[model samples]
Target: MPEVFTAYVRIVDGFNRRVGRIVMYGIFVLMGILLYSSMSKTMFLPAHWTLEMAQFVMAGYYLLGGAYSLQLDSHVRMDLLYGRWSPKTKAVVDVVTILMLFVYLFFLLYGGVSSTAYALQYSETSYSSWSPYMAPVKIVMVIGIALMFLQATSILIKDIAVAIGRPLP
Candidate 1:
């Protein structure tokens, strides 16, 4: 592979690693906040924003973790047949499958970007008592999908190189 392409893949991997760790770390914060909110509500001093805050954090956690999951090959899949395939065969299958996934991701990323823009434009908020701004959440969705696609592209490149006679860097 070219030096530039190698650098790009390494950068994508590093980005996912950093994002994954940050999101993982935030889970502790989420837990603490949730506990506080539950206790407050039990004591008749409800933190109305807590539930919504948790939702935002959880959504971000899952979305941002997607690329990391893919990178680590930890994403859920029914791999009964796939597990039996040889490495080159797996690469071939992955190449085709990643193309199909990209088709879906294109629409999701497009919608996410458009929705995020709309939210930002209108300063949209959820229709709830705690109605925090929706832009930040929507922005996370856009960013997450984009990152997944980026990771997928990196994987696809490596798969292609391996599927062929070339050795991957």
Candidate 2:
């Protein structure tokens, strides 16, 4: 692989790793929120925001962790044939599939950005009791999707290198 492609993979991988590690702690935040909700309901006036906040945190956790999961190859796959394939064969197949992933991510990112814009422009709020502004979560979603897209691109580069018998380290 060329220096530029190798550098791009390194940078994207490093950034996604850092983001994933930081986002992992969000699970604890979610647990704390749920705990507080339970305590408040029994001992005091229930907070109106707990459920929605938990949902937002969970969405952040899942979406933000996606690229890291991909990096680790931890996402579920139908390994019926994949596990038996040789390394180069796997790389060849991955390149093709990752192209499809790019298309999906492109559409997802476009919609996320559009929805985020609408949220910001209209000051959109959830139709709930707490009625929190939607922009913050929407922004997080966009960031997560963009990160996943970058990570997918990095994977594609690496796969291409492998397929060409010039694998990057």
Worst 10 residues of 1 by lDDT: 160-169
Q: TM-scores for all candidates?
A: 0.94, 0.98
Model 2 reaches what TM-score against the true structure?
0.98
Give per-residue CA lDDT, model 1, range 82-162, as digits (tens).
Answer: 999989999999899999989988999999999999999999999999889999999998899999999999888888877
lDDT for 64 (candidate 1) = 89
Where model 1 places Cα greater than 4 Å from the true spot, the runs are none
Per-residue lDDT tens digits of candidate 2, residues 1-169? 7799999999999999999999999999999999999999999999999999999999999899999988888888999999999889999999999999999999999999999999999999999999999999999999999999999999999999999998999
lDDT of 1 at 24: 80
List lDDT for all candidates, in order. Answer: 0.89, 0.95
Best by lDDT: 2
Report the error of model 1 at residue 105, Å: 1.2
